[model samples]
Target: MAKTYKDVKIPEELFFNIKNFIEKYSELGFRSVSEFVNSSARNEMERIEDRKRNE
Candidate 1:
């Protein structure tokens, strides 16, 4: 099942950067920026968890 989220407000420059990054990735088939970011965050978090476990 899918989940819903609240909207976040960001500065124009930051939002534009995200827009451009997502556009570049869209050519590789990601559906949206949020999907891309969520996956990216999950990967980073897992990496951090691994390091913590090792420590």
Candidate 2:
């Protein structure tokens, strides 16, 4: 299922933390911050799902 996009308001500190993470990860060849973060998240989810299925 596709997720719907929603406008979210995050606190400044949280946004800065996210930005800092993205900046560090970007050095490892990730293109956009959103793409990089989302992809990494999805990959972890998929791994968990696969593990559950195998078990």
Candidate 3:
């Protein structure tokens, strides 16, 4: 499936943390910090939707 991504800006500190994590754990299969953040954002979105549905 083709992904339609939306660009969003986050705080520099948070971005730095993500980059730090990417360097600390390179074996997680994430090629870049953006990919790692995108994957984590998708999971958080799903969790939010699930909780909303339950409510």
Candidate 4:
């Protein structure tokens, strides 16, 4: 089966900021703003789950 994706809307200013940051720090390996956001969101979710388990 093929995977489907959906769009998540963010403010234009924030998008531009992320784009600039990615361009400045190309070593981070983020191909696009979406990749950065997806990784960030996954990390945060894992952190929150760990905290809840600890508590």
Candidates in order, TM-scores: namely 0.63, 0.51, 0.72, 0.93
RMSD of 3: 2.5
lDDT of 2 by residue, 5-48 (tens): 75546587866777787788677776554666577779999999
- Per-residue lDDT over 1-55 for candidate 4, one digit per residue giving the tens place of the 0 to 100 score: 9989999999999999999999999999999999999999999999999999999
lDDT of 4: 0.98
Where is the poorest 10-residue window by lDDT in model 4?
Answer: 1-10
* Candidate 4: Cα lDDT at 16: 99
Clashes of 1: 0
The C-alpha stretches of model 4 lying farther than 4 A from their native spots are: none
Off by over 4 Å in 1: 8-10
lDDT of 1 at 49: 100
Prediction 2 global C-alpha lDDT: 0.75
How far does residue 8 in candidate 2 sit from its true spot (Å)? 6.3
lDDT of 3 at 55: 100
lDDT (Cα) of model 3: 0.89
Clashing pairs in 1: none
- Cα RMSD for candidates in order: 2.4, 4.0, 2.5, 0.7
* Candidate 2, superposed: residue stretches over 4 Å from native: 1-12
Which rank order by lDDT, best down to worst?
4, 3, 1, 2
